[model samples]
Target: MVLLVPIIGGVVALGLLVWCCVCRRKRSSDDEPTRPPDTSSLDTAAKSLGFLETLLTDDRVLIRRRFDIRDIQFERPLSKGAFGEVWLCTDRQNTMLAVKKLLQHKNDAYKEIKDFIAEIQLTASLDHPHIIRFLGVAWTSMDNLCMALEYLPTGDLLAFLRQNADMLTWVKDKLPMALGVAHALEYLHNRPTPIIHRDVKAKNVLLTEQLQTKLIDFGISRDRTQETMTAGVGTPYWSAPEVLEGNRYTEKSDIYSFGVLLSEIDSAATPYKDVRSPETGEPLRVWQIVSMIVGGSLRPTFSDACPQRIARVAKACLDGDPNVRPSANEVIEMLLGRAVSDQNW
Candidate 1:
């Protein structure tokens, strides 16, 4: 009976061991499908540099679609900035587009990532003819973030002015181009949430093959409903006096830049090109120009070549006081009201 009890206890022990093994196997099997994603292949540098997760804003949430990296064929690099590289790319249908690949930095990737996302969000929300179109953004498995944008073949207005000086010298052509820019600003300023284009300059204005003008580069643009912006963050030569004084930027600041663009179109001369430093007779540096502007000493000299009416409008736009500067709509009205025959000096 003692030997029988011992054998029976051994059998029960073996059975319990078998049952525990079976239960463990079943549990593991169930968990196999629900296991966390395997990111084992990504090394430390690649995990930090390449990994990106998309977070859409309320504006882009419903409209913008995420694209796959496999669909983009990056052909050539068009431009490069501190945060990313803008490449000329083609899609599946062979359509040309500009794609910006945003890279992560070791120390400041978080804010850059946020800004890049914000740029895509704001750009995607806009659907105006004169505003550059935002196609889509992509987050690849390898952690690269890309934003596809509309390609303007003719390049920016700065280059266009350089190439087509003859076309711009005439008020007939110049007025229309100026009007197009005004209309674009009017659309932006009148939106439900007004967008202040903090960095408005000739380089930010792009021309289409059809000679259509479109405003691009909303990287520094801000919606007015947010906190007030008080940074000096624009092309120094095109900055308003108030901006140079470190005052908060308003829509009037854009008008100040437009005034410089007006002089650019009229004489094909860059703003403050003739302003020489008293100490060295060399052209004034950007800082000096800003000092002169803020000190209420320097103003863009409208060449005798510029018509009186156009010069008058430019002068109005360059008013030192922000309150005195004409709204974009008012500037458009004044330009449209003037006839080509009325462009007399």
Candidate 2:
């Protein structure tokens, strides 16, 4: 037994010596200047350990840009609205853009300023063919927020309708424009959290060189899921009766406004512009027309040129009962069905 112990100890020590020599030789081989470490194997091990994902999981691709005010040069003021003034601006790259600048200086301008910023942010996230595209936002040295939006060379729908009244003859121009606006509304209302465009008027609809209609001006828009219904937030002329009455308005209010816009497009004039006052027998003032709308008596008069089907769709939209009013998607179906029926005949 004692002799076997000595032999076993000698074998164990010899095995230890061989292992140490092998490890030393491996270290010396690793230190060779000409031999590069197996980085491909190391990368495979790293991926197996999720090291790459751990480093890149937090590295997100930024989709929005922050522009410096100095990069933009204002050319001229295009138009002024309740929220801000839009200008024709030129960027550092000599790119022409339309910039909306909020000029609220009053003490009570916080909400208005917030809405302006919100519109910029909201518009930035939307990407639809019929919805206006947002470029980026600029913070002026004077601490004012401005939005750079896509420039529509053909002006707004109101101006286009007035200047080109001959184009609204039939299915070629006017119906397509109406359908485009309807599709934009559908896009907004069909979002997971529906967006109600508080202001939907001809003046807020821009036209491109190809006469493509695009919806714009989301200063007073509300998300159905997140926002509380507020009344009296839209333009009085194009606003729905319920909105004028300071009632809790819904997406149906936009349909009512779109009805008015249809009338504007058909007549090539502003709503109530030609309507005579019942009592005075003269052209009614804007306030008087608003009163009539709230009274549920006066509505936009359809011109003789307006097709009966289009008029019917508009009438349905202008229904006093919001519950009976058709949704934007329904409006498109009505218009398209009418078009198909007419063609079939």
Candidate 3:
């Protein structure tokens, strides 16, 4: 009887231990984050070699710029957007490159393909120190239609500023970055066709190891010659009032965005982040802020530490009337402490 009791107790304890382990595993499984669906096969199907060949053959410039994928090796991903992703890659000579790939599983539509081709062409044609350099385009199949560009090791301006907030200063860090972007904007605005960078925020600006700025991401840029330029298609915080109101996007709109960027440099935060309701003391909702901006009653705030000269330029850029905004050249001259001649707008 004594031996039987010990054996029975051991069995009951074993059962309890099993139940506890099973319960723990259940809890763990519930707590685990849900993994994104694996779309590798879909990505492969989208990069069909036949489709890539067809698209390349249609464009003469693309035909000449065809890159042999065999010479390139894939590295880790750097960033991602709605339609595609940018990857860090290396060439046969071990040169580092940023490769932007357009990955869509659906059948190739004419408009989408044309826009992508135009973006590649525009990027390749640009030649400026402040602009991101284009290397070439490559593809194994349609899913991998990729553009190779110069890789800046220091990353985008927004992240760099946030990460190095404590160490950065106005003259040494901020001024140069602002100047580089201004130069880039001036170049774009003075182009033969006068390009309008639809999006001109800090995230679109990249930095070098030396902290020099390089303006990038021309996915939505358009020549001033294009008809119907009223699409409200940029980030909300950096967008000009006219752009937010679905009015025509002019070079002046870019100037307004530049002004917002100046404030970003001063605060190291998103535009209008400090704005709050007087009654509730809570941050204003996005829609409320947008309404106030379009109504001309609100503008991005500058920190007290911001230099008076820079603050003045920022205010001029954020003027309610687009006609009152300073030109990119004027902004540059202002920053340089040179006299800016009055322009009859």
Candidate 4:
């Protein structure tokens, strides 16, 4: 009856082996936070899976495989969004680059690593003084897709506006931001191949040490030259009439967006306000904002300090007819106090 000792011993040994493997896996997961194995990086894993190659054919892999992400010094996360989390990162050369870590889930077969890689590529190609410089990229076998970008420590325009709302102080901060951002838009719009920053919100505009405004977060941005579209999207409040009609977009679309951004920056008011239902408190999306602007329901809500000239500048940008909108250069001239009014003629 008690002769089953050998069988029981084998079962116990098998259980111990399973337990050891589980413990080893747990240890491996923990080790990655400190010094992850090279093979576990998204770059390596993507190569191994071949999913990145297949999926990145569109725009995600346009400029990948350029710069190397040899080493990284991870810092606290600066912001989080639907696309990913942006972290302050220092590259191998000790250059500070903002790293965007995608939360696209582990084992996602879509191969967005190329897009992750492409962001750096697209960024590096632009050399405008007003735009944020594209530094480099970090690709490995890790679950993360780290994009190393020039770090702008002064934070975004939204923060700048929130902290300096009073008119006495607003003028000091507002003028530079408006002028700088106008220059950025002018640069993007005037490019041989134009680009539309589809998500042109206050949060996306970062300020530098010199107080110059730099555009950031092009996740939803469409390089108008690269990807021409009859219909696409952008933030609601800033969306123009042509965009709302689902018509083709061009540099003028960006102008329309700038108009809304100008309104938001000058007035310091949230987009699509006073329209939320009291029951749910949920707000509308970009499409809804576009609808409102299209229906003539949206207005700039100009402040007392917002000069009529600025009003006209904003209106020119927000004009329902994209054909009638002013160029970024024109906006810049107006903002810089060099605008020649039509009345002068």
User: Which is superior by TM-score, 1 or 2?
Assistant: 1
Error of 4 at 64 (Å): 11
- Model 1 scores a C-alpha lDDT of 0.70
lDDT of each: 0.70, 0.72, 0.76, 0.63
Model 1 C-alpha lDDT per residue in residues 209-300, reported as the tens digit of each score? 87778888887788876553554456666878777665667888988888878877776667776766455667655554555566556677
lDDT, model 4, position 31: 21
List candidate 1 segments past 4 Å from native: 1-54, 57-64, 141-143, 278-280, 338-345
The local distance difference test score of model 4 is 0.63
TM-scores for every candidate against the unseen true structure: 0.79, 0.76, 0.81, 0.72
Higher-lDDT candidate of 2 and 3? 3
Best candidate per lDDT, number?
A: 3
Task: Point out where model 3 deviates above 4 Å.
Answer: 1-61, 107-109, 341-345
Error of 3 at 260 (Å): 0.6
Arrange candidates by TM-score, highest first: which order?
A: 3, 1, 2, 4
lDDT of 3 at 265: 78
Write one digit per residue (lDDT tens) for candidate 2, span 1-345: 000011222222332233344435533442244333345575654443343223222322212465778898999999986557999999988898999887766532434454555566678768899999888766633236677889998999999998989756757899989999999999999988788998899988999899889999987787776434556456776777666655566889999989988888888887766666445667655655555566566688787777888988888888888888888988898888743332211
* Model 3 per-residue lDDT tens digits across residues 80-174: 98777899999989999999887674643323454576688889889999999988888765546789999999999888889988898898889
The collision pairs in model 2 are: none
Candidate 3 Cα RMSD after full superposition onto the native fold (Å): 17.5
